[model samples]
Structure formats: C-alpha cells, structure tokens
Target chain A: MNLFLDALAWIVAPERFEGSSSLFVRLGEHLYFTAFSVLIATVIAVPIGYLIGHTGRGRELAVGLSGAARALPSFGLILLLVLVMGVTNKPAAAFTAFVVLAIPSILAGAYAGFEAIERRTINAARAVGMTEWQILWRVEVPLGLPLLIGGIRSAALQVVATATLAAYIGLGGLGYYIFRGLPLGRYDEMLGASILVAVLAIVIDAALALCQRLFVPRGVAAGRTPSLRTAPARRRAMVETSTAP
Target chain B: MNWVLDNLDLIGRLSLEHLRLSITPILAGLLIAIPLGWLAHRYRLARGALLTSAGLLYTIPSLALFVIIPPILGISYLSELNVTIALTLFVIAIMARSVADALDSVDGNVRQSAVAVGYGALRRFFTVDLPLAGPVILSGLRVAAASTVSLVTVGILIGVESLGYLFTNGYQRRIVEEIFSGVVMVMLVALLIDLALVALGRLAMPWARRPGRAAR
Candidate 1:
C-alpha cells in the first residue's frame, strides 16, 4: 500500500508530471494506429465478406479463416511480426492489427446480413434486370447494413484494446506507461494507464453501440424490437400451450 | 526437427508451467460467475447492470490490467493471483451472460409446470432450469477457458514464468526455436482445453450432443 501511495505521489509531483505529456502523445499515436487499421480492415473485410456471403461458394472457408484469425493469440502474432518487420510501427502495429482485428466481425456481419435477406427479394431485383453489382448495392448491402455495422463495432473495440500491446515492440502508447511502470515498481502509473485503457474501451464500445442504433434502418429496428420484446412472453405461451394438451 | 530435438526438455517444462498457471484460475472464475449469473437472471432488474459491469471489465487490456495490479498488490511471480483476478473479471462477464441467456432459453413451460407442481423456486431451479441451462453455461465456460489459456500468456509479459515467458524471451534474444516452442505450447494448451471442455459439456449435459440445439 505504501508503495502504491508513493508511486501515486511520484506521478503527481510537478516535476514528474511534466514527463506525462508524452503519455498523451503516445495515446494519440495509439488511437491513430488503431483507427487506421480498423478502417482498412473494414474496407477489405466488408467487401470480401459480402462477395463470399452472397455468392455462397467457399463461404465456409472464408468464415473459418476469419475465425482462425481471431483465435490466433495477438501476443504471438505481434511477436511474429516483430521478427519479420523488425519493430517499426507501420508494419508492426498498424498493418498487423488490421489483419488480426478486421476479419472476424466483417465476415460474420456480411454472412449474417446477406443470409438474412429474403431470396425472393434478390430474385425480383435480378428479374427486373439489375446487374450483379446493382443487386449487391441496391439489395444486399443496404439490408445487410445493420449486421455489418455490428461487426464493425466489435472489430473497433477489439482493435483499440489489443493495440496497447504494441508497446512491447517499443511503439509508444498507454501500454508504455503500464509496461515501463511495472518493472520500476510504479503502481500509480500502471493504475492510471489501466484506467485510461478501460475508459477508452468503454467509450469506444458505447459510441459504436450508438452508431449501430443510428445506422440500423428504422424498418429493421422496428421489426426486431417487437420480436425482442415478445420473446419471453412467446416462450411462456408456448410452455403453457405445450403442457395444456 | 533439429530445434525440437535440442530443446525438448525445456519445451516440456514450459508447457507444463503454462497449463498450471492457466487452468485453476479459469475454473475458479467459471465456478463463481455461473452462480452470479443465475442470481442475476432471477432478479430481472439486476441483469443489465451486472452484464454491463462484466462487459466493462472485459474491455480492459490484459497487459494493462497486469501492470496495474503489481503496484496495488505488490509484485511477485505469485503474480499468478493478479492474473487470476484479471482473468476472473473477464470470465465472469462472459459466463454470466451465457448463463442468463441459457436460463432464459429454457422451455418456460418446464418452469411453470414445476412451479404448479409445488416445487419451490430452489428446487425448480436445480431440477429444471439448471439442467436445461447447463449446455449454454458450459458453452460459455468453453469459450472462457480457451481464451483464458491465451490470456494467461499475457502474464509472462509482466514477468510470470509460463510458455509466454519463453515466447517473450525468444523475441528478445532472437531465438527462433524458443519462439516456435512457446507458440506451439500455447496453441496446444488452448486446443486441449477446448477439447476437454467440449467433452465435459457432452458428459455433463447430454442435450449438447446435438450441435446447434444448444446456444451457439
């Protein structure tokens, strides 16, 4: 406890506090890396996932690959990149995170969204002479938008949190504070870093949740709300009906 | 092949250490979280708050959580305790959500019938809800356990001795074989845990025998 207090005091001391400006700079760098990676991943993943999910060929392979990507340990992957890329932020942090973070949500979203669309609607669009791209843009993407957004939300949160581990490769971020503080027995610095990371995750997740609500079409939202609200009651009714006879 | 031959003993020791560090804490976390989740389900208003809190904990970066603990609790290799805490925080949220969802998925008639038959709330829960909900809860545990295997490796970055220690060491020292050994060990541990959990799920909840019948 004394060590913790002392660490806190050290962090607050004006002289020590002066060095803290770097913490903010590091945070900005971290966010920049994460944001770019997520953006790139979204662009690649969404389109690829849509194509596969719509085409219905090699979909199992695509989805399985994405799941595999997600399952691979970030620490191990990051370390592997360090070996190949030699510790620069661009390849080590930004590029790797893009590949690791983007695949699962994008694929799942596209697959779920495309699969959810009614077959007759697609047939009508095609029957009316819509091009394949037209059917995709006019029919699939719009309808799938809600689920796609859900995927992006998850991908964004994951990328932001995992990006902190970039500190291991000497790219500065809030993780730098945590990693540097740990070896030196600086508890307050670690606490501050942890709190900041946690808060950032919550803020990002909440913001994404709001975005999902905003971007999801009103019709879909309306459709889902009634079902969600009545699910329990429906189950209860089913129970009663089943037992009655 | 040459690399494996040279470091077989070291790899074996590291693998054993990683398994030791990961297994117990996750089991403990699952044990605690499932009951809390059940409680949350019983009380309607508490469910959202409980899940949200757990979700919040889930977001904290594993490395950041590790660094934060030593300062507060004081650091040691026994930092196993801290890793356990951090792992627990994540597992609780996951397990709780899964448990609540599973309970909700149970045939409502089962519960209503049990109630009508004069089975008390506790008895109904034990005999009906728990059995029906078991598969979903186990699925959650499987996910938590698999992830915990990976997360426990983060403990190494903070100075705990495990397979992750080998990975980090290999990176720092530029020993490719050691890195391979560490990576392979962690993956094997994760796979084994997943298989074990699946087997347990099958044995404990016969309903899980049919895939997709339980909550995916």
Candidate 2:
C-alpha cells in the first residue's frame, strides 16, 4: 500500500511532469512509437488483407504467417533484429519489429471483416448491377469496417503495450522509467510509469471500441455487425484468437 | 552456434523453467475461468459485467501487471509467484470469454435433453455441457498456451530466470546465435504444447472428428 501510494504521488509530482525525461515526454514518445508502427502496418496489411478476402486466395499463407508471428517472443525478436541489423540505426530495427508485431492482427482484422459479410447480401449487390470494384466498395468495405477497426483496435493496443518493451532497446518512451528505475530500485518511478501505460491502453481501447460500435453500419440493426460487441460467440472467439498479440 | 553448443545445459534448464512457468498459469487459469465463465453464462444479469471486466483486464500489459502484482501481493517484485498470478489473470481474461462463448455454443436442445434424462446439474455439466464445450475451450486453451509461453519470456527483464535469460544475456554479449536460439526455443515449446493439446482433444473427444462436430 505504501508503494502504491508513492506511485500515485509520483504521478502527481510537478517535478516529474516536466524536463527532458519527464512523464509527459515519455508518454508522447510512447504514443508516437505506437501510432507510427500501426500506421505502417495498416498500409502494408490492409491491401494484402483485401486481396486475400476479395479473391479468396493465399488465405492459408496469411493464417499460417500470422500464427507463426503470434508464437514468437517479441523480446527475442527485438534483440535479434537489433543485433542482426547493427544497433547503429536502432529506430529502423525497433520500428520494424513493432510493425511485425502489428501486422498479424491488422491483416486478420482486414480479411476477417470481409469474410464476416453475408453471402446473400453480396449476391444481391451483384444482381443489382454492381461491378467487382463497385461491389467491394459499396458492400464489403462498409460492412467490414467494424472488424477492421477491431483488428486495428487490438493491433494498436498491442503496439502501445510493446512500445514500452521497445524502450528495452534504448528508445525513449514511458518504459524508460520502468526499465531505468528497476536497475536502481526506484519503485515509485517504475510503478507510476506502468500505471500510466495501463491507463493509456484502456483509454485507447475504449475509444476504439466506441469507434467500432459507431461505424457498424446502421443497416445492421436486426442482425449484429461482426465486431466483438455484437457478433455471436463463435465469430468473436475467432477474432479473439487473432487479436491476442 | 559455438555459444549455443557450449550453453546446452543452461538452455535445457531454462527451457524447463520456461515450460513450468508457462504451464502453471494456463492450467490454473482454466480452472478459474470455467467457473467464472459458468457464472457469466448462467446469470443473464451478470453476463455484460463479467465479460466487460475480463475484457478490461487484457488491456493491462503483462509487464505492467508483473510490476503491479508484487506491490499488491507483498511478494518480491522478482518472485516467480508474481509471474504466475499475473499470467493467470491474463489467461482468465482470454479464456473466460471463450468459455462463456463455448457454453453458449452448446445446443440449447441438447442441454434440454440432458435435463430431461434426469441428470443433475453437476452431472450434466460434466458429461454433457462440459464435453460439448470441450472443443471450443480447447481452442481457447491453445491460444492461451502459445501466448503464455511467449509472455513468460518478459520476466527476464525483471530478473526472473527462464529461457528469457538468454535474450538479455545474448544481447549484452552481442551473441546473434544465442538470441536466435532463444527465439526458436520459445516458439518450439509453444508449437509442441499446441500439438499436445490437439492430441489430447482428439483422445478425449472422438466425436469431434466426425460431421457436425468438426474441429476448429
């Protein structure tokens, strides 16, 4: 309880909030790493997800790749990458590691979002004189947005959490406090920083969950959209397996 | 390769520690999650609350949880117990939802028939509901297993010993082969656990291989 109290005080200490290595600066660096990695992952993954979903090809490759990635220890991956790539350009190696961490969930989210759409609806869209491009945009993308966001939701959460670990490689983030504090027995700084990271994760997750709910097509009223909140147990469970990283 | 060969005994010992650390929480979490999942499923009033709390738990990173546990539990921050407790929480978060969902997936009529045959709630749960829920639970188990094994490696940062020691030790020494070997060994352990779970599922649920009872 005393340690917890000290941690809470540490969070409120004005001295801790400013300066080059202040709480706010580390927080900023943390979110910056998270957003940067997720952005790159999104660009690379969403298109591949689209190709897999739209054409129903190479899905085994996607699934197999993602599964393999999930089993990898992120800590090991970072250290290995840093050593292999030469630590001189640490950001490239670290962010590449972060991108790898983000890709599987986003890719699964993108493709699974498309797969969640009703087959009959797609047939109807085609019958109404929609071309391939038109059907994909008009029917698939809007409906699949919810799961895509869910994927991004989990991916962003993963990156946010791992960005803390990225600090292990000497990048600046909130993790700097915890990693730096531990060796020196600075419990307040370590505990205080972890609480901040947890809060950041929860707030981002709630925001994304809201985004998922809001962007669920208004037409999906009677039947639930395929996002975890409203999707049936089975579908959400499938999403859970992919999103765990 | 030379470092790895020289450290064979160290690797074997850490691998055992890694497996022990990983498996404890998975087994313990399953035991806790089933009851929690049952509570969520059995009581409509609590379903939303139970599941939402479980969802919230996952958002807290394992590393954060690792640090937070010692303070709360009065254990040393570096103790193996803290790792198990924190990991068990995560597995519960992942599995409880899946367990509730797994129970929900059990056909309503099938459960009704079990009740009709005069089986008590406990009896039916064991013979019918649980068995029926087994495959889904096993899948959730597999996911939890793989991730748990991987997550256990993070404890090295806090000075808890496991295969994760290789990561820190290798990085400090700049031993590329050593780091590579650590990564491979963790994945290998996870893969072996996954296969074992699959085999156990097959042995326990023969009907699962047939039509209408397919494996996931």
lDDT of each: 0.73, 0.88
lDDT tens digits by residue: candidate 2, A19-115: 8998878888988998999999999999999889888899889988887787889888888999999999788888998999999999999999999
Report how far off residue B21 is in candidate 2 (Å): 1.0
Off by over 4 Å in 1: A1-21, A87-94, A116-135, A224-245, B69-78, B211-216
Model 2 ranges with Cα > 4 A deviation: A222-245, B211-214
The TM-score obtained for chain B by all candidates, in the order given, is 0.90, 0.96
True contacts kept of each: 0.35, 0.59
Scored against the true structure, residue B76 in model 1 reaches a CA lDDT of: 57
Q: Using lDDT as the measure, which candidate wins?
A: 2
Please give the TM-score for the first chain of candidate 2.
0.89
DockQ of each: 0.38, 0.47
| Residue-level lDDT tens digits of model 1 in B5-110 | 8888988897888888778877878788878888777766678788888777776777766755555556552467778777777778678888888887777677
Model 1 docking grade: acceptable
Q: Candidate 1, residues A1-245: lDDT per residue as tens digits?
A: 76556555654566533464565576787778777888878777877788777898777787556545544567766776677566554455446755566668777888788988989989999999999999998888888887888888778767776678767777676677777776786666766677677777778878877877787767767889975775453233224443221
| Lowest lDDT 10-residue stretch of candidate 2 chain B | B207-216
Measured over the true interface residues after superposition, the C-alpha RMSD of each candidate is 4.8, 7.7
